[model samples]
Target chain A: MRRQLLFTALGAAIALTSPLAGAAGDELNFDAYREMLADGNPAELLEMEGEELWRTARGPKNATLEQCDLGRGPGVVEGAAAQLPRYFADTDKVQDLESRLMHCMEAQQGIPSAEIINGQFLKGERGKLAALVAYVVTHSKGKPIAIDLSHPRVKEMYDMGERAFRYRTGAMDFACSSCHSQDGKRIRATQLPNITKPEGAAEGWSSWPAYRVSNSQFWTMQHRLWDCFRQQRTAEPVFASDVTIALSVFMAGKGNGAEARWPGVKR
Target chain B: MKKLFLALPLALGLSGASADELQTRVEQMMLDSFKANGIAGLDRQKQDAVQKACSGLTPPDAETMKKLEAAEMATIKWPTDGNFTGGDWKEGQKIAASGRGLTWTDKTADNNGGGCYNCHAMDPKEVSEGTIGPSLEGYGKLRGSSEEVVKYTWGKLWNSKAYNACSDMPRNGYGGILTETQIRHVMAYLFDPASPVNQ
Candidate 1:
């Protein structure tokens, strides 16, 4: 682990000293640093672990999630993330991959909902829900996001999502649109992705579940949204709640057709 | 009679409500989705007039913006002591550089950082400074602390939305983000000639 960190640091140091650095007035050099770290994203470990979790039988019901349907057929994992945040007939609601995963854990494996909700967000850690999500999303990598809006519930979610994105209420009065609607903006050396347009939203939404170097953590989209809500100074969103799924639908839909670039590296 | 009474429930389903039902349901969802922790309460999700207007899916018109700005500006609380630069610059520097505060994990409410460096280029030496807002590197040197400059700077830091209703910047004073003394320290950090911001 120490050696790996050294190699990562060396990559960062080399990129920081490059003449290309600071040319964009990005003296903090976050983009350059991220490019250097891209070679060995830590999210890879999580993906492998998620695959293990999907096949292993360790839960209360002694069942694996291999038979769980993710918008495709039962036990289907390929390209499922490409059309996520869709309506699930069993639950009769619109759900993102994480929400659906939670439902499966409860229904298929009989794992208590509360335990999964409060579970740690680690990659290799036991019962880490994010790791399983990583495994599922990995299959859909590079596929274009194609959210299905055929269901009326899906439309309702999308509509609510649009409203939620623009709704500003907090101590800071920051809506998601505040930092993202504009172009060429950064918050402390980090570029805020514009999630208002198809191209920008796709680019923004596509490269999530990134491996953050500063914290050495693999963050899923749900975790990313959690951080965003925290920064917005709003109440902590319940894990995989309707509001979260709706926002995912809104963003994933806007970014529809943007290639899924999962397990991205970040500073 | 019991059957008729039970049939009333089916009657409700037969009767249709508004097509705008999704919007109303989403509102309820929003209420149910979040929970308060630490210093942040659920009430933080309630929108003020300025926030409501500014958070439109489309940008509000100029006429709407003017009215919202006026309402937002009225919320700014000026320094009661009539002194904006009386606090220490060293403390100001820490506050300017910090981006921590008001989160659920945060321990206290009094030590919130201005997070100024998160969005503005403060000291030229601080390469990690953000570019979201304008640089204040030579604030005192470029624009001396004239009466108007001092007042305007103070107000800007207090309620950024006063001048620009839709600004991405937080309303530090109006939002209870910083105490007046902390704002005073930030004032000194900007205007003090000895501060690195000027050099």
Candidate 2:
């Protein structure tokens, strides 16, 4: 696959440049391991299913989502996911990919938003949505993440999102910042990215909608954030809520100009 | 009354809201976004005074930190039997290794993990230990079980904020995340000569 080739090429480049020693060398080795696992990611199977669903007519209206608008106009799958969490005029609100999909599924396919809003991850409507998310983000692979923060509402959401990032609560007294505000830290063995910085935010934001090897399931960004709050010992957030969108805006906006590596493979 | 005050600005529009007003809006938005499920309730979103002081963009001033630490120190419950590090180190090792409990999936509060290994190295041989907190690989060997050391360890485990106001470490005893017996076991795990942490 293209990503495998890219990783192999990157690994070779790093091997040629840096002397194999210390943390950087360890990181290069980890990347090589990741490249090995990333070959034939399980999310690819889901992506294929999503592509089929996108073209198939099966919703209440018996309509395919081929005409669904993803902020690049109707049926425009190319590079659409790169510029999402944008202000949508039709709904008079800012929406990320999943929420926008909820709209399109409702308006174009006659499927209700509640089907996903109340649904569990990788089950029922949510499962279908995850597949669709995989298909959509794959189009934006290696594209620069460029979310617009010009809209007043969007700017407001971004500010609030930054606040939410630092808002510590729950039994453990954790904000998203608790784990993510620093670089080169880990929770147990898993690496944590410092989402306050550009590179780290991009690493956190763009690499998700990933295939999680541990659970053997594809996790969209919403699913990832939901579990983050769960681990923080907080209450369950409603699916695709404004708070989630706001947090997405903060991340994507901060990560502006970084490459999106959606449908990423993860441990 | 508090809900109405928080909700009023967002009802009109957040366009003209101040930084403080926007913070209030974000808090309300969080309150609106989450719902109680299983044992995890919406009340978990509520921040205590100590949590509020620490959740700022920067750490609170030194005076406020001292006050907060003092208040937190008052909450520590020293072992009633005056026996510290008396429990089995084996049980403590299990508690230290577990990163479970308090999530919605967990059925009971009594069965919980110290989650110590999630942030600190217990046994020197454990390669997967986290680096968030200092490594405690040879806690007993390095800092012998003097009266002062034992008492400080007990208080720190009970309420980490008692020592540092904004420590990332959880209040294992104060938060009721671990029981008294559990804490005692973890103490032994750190101090016991037979424990792998000391070996």
Candidate 3:
């Protein structure tokens, strides 16, 4: 009995001391780890797959997305992703990359937009859409973010987005600014960037279509935006909604001149 | 015999002194080993006054804690329009699930992710979520959208330190990690009945 009691005490002591003892002075060596993994980012594979999807003619209409215009000329995919959330004269609406992809899937491939939008991120034809995004965004890698705000609609959307950003409601009465409007702040160990500053906006706006280590899946900008709503415990924004595009525009515009780093790796 | 006994006591004292010296040396060595890069700088290693007080210490006195919280609250930038709760919830949902942007390799121009799921369980249906923060499922159902609630929520997001001086929650708005519109969408996602978070 005494031995068992001593063992239990020892176990309790070990548990209590382990985390405190281990965490005393060891900080995360992020730079060294990042350097080691830089050469073999999994985003490379997704980019290759996306390229194939963009060129391959496999839709119901047996058409390819090669002719899709992402704010550039027809069939242009290079550096287009960095300039999206812009007004498309053809659609008479501002669209982001995902929304544009839906348009191409419907117009060129004869596939229904609803079907493509409804499908899972990596399942069926929608998966192909994700791959296409990966490929297109990768082409814009290292390019400067140059979202066009010269258009009247673009300016209007920016204003609207600003208002929406400050709007607060819900059980917790949380607003986006509540978590994002400060500097030198952190949640757990993750530092929160201030979106109001140029450096912060630039740093915060240009990396997207990243692979989430926890989910083991690739996430586009659309997916990234939608998930924020979930945490807010608010209504789920529609897929490719105008408000969503406007927010994208607002963020991208703020991050002007920031280099694009799509298909990025994330912890 | 007297000389030998005196030497043993002195030797013991010297050994204790050496142990303390070793501890200090190790602590200094650890502090010097780190290097800053990109958005992450060496300043991160240094703790604020509140953090230093809290570090390896007991909880702070109420008066000191209140003072720190007040200082943090002063940093909040309230919305100019006085509008709270107008963004579509659907858009908010998209923002919550994303955990992208802001790393050593990431360019200064990229969009940063909220990475909410890395800490909190927002949706009951989501099987994969970290436990760092409390589960936020049914947040709207449990609490209604009121003016006080709305303002508080905004305050929390704009500067979590306003509420809790040493809160683990990030200051999203103040930090520029998220834009105003993105925050609006996130707010909608939490309140909208049709949102997955509510469901």
- The interface root-mean-square deviation of each model, in the order shown, is 6.0, 4.6, 23.2
Candidate 2 clashing pairs?
none
lDDT of 2 by residue, A2-121 (tens): 656744564564465432233331352245545765666668878988998899997889999999999998999999999989988899999999999989898988999998898899
lDDT of 3 by residue, B42-106 (tens): 44433455443333213468898899889878888777897656778766766777765544345
Off by over 4 Å in 1: A1-39, A123-127, B1-23, B61-63
lDDT of 2 at A194: 96
- How would you encode candidate 1's per-residue C-alpha lDDT over B129-153 as one tens digit per residue? 6666888899988999888999888
Which of the two candidates, 2 or 3, achieves a greater TM-score against the reference? 2
Question: Per-chain TM-score of chain B, candidate 2?
Answer: 0.91
Q: Which pairs clash inside model 1?
A: none
Judged by TM-score relative to the true structure, which candidate is superior, 1 or 2? 2
Q: What tens digits encode model 1's per-residue C-alpha lDDT throughout A156-200?
A: 677678888877877778778767776767787677777888877
Give the C-alpha lDDT of model 1.
0.80
Model 3 misplaced stretches (Cα beyond 4 Å): A1-32, B1-199
Cα-lDDT of candidate 3: 0.65
Ranking by lDDT: 2, 1, 3
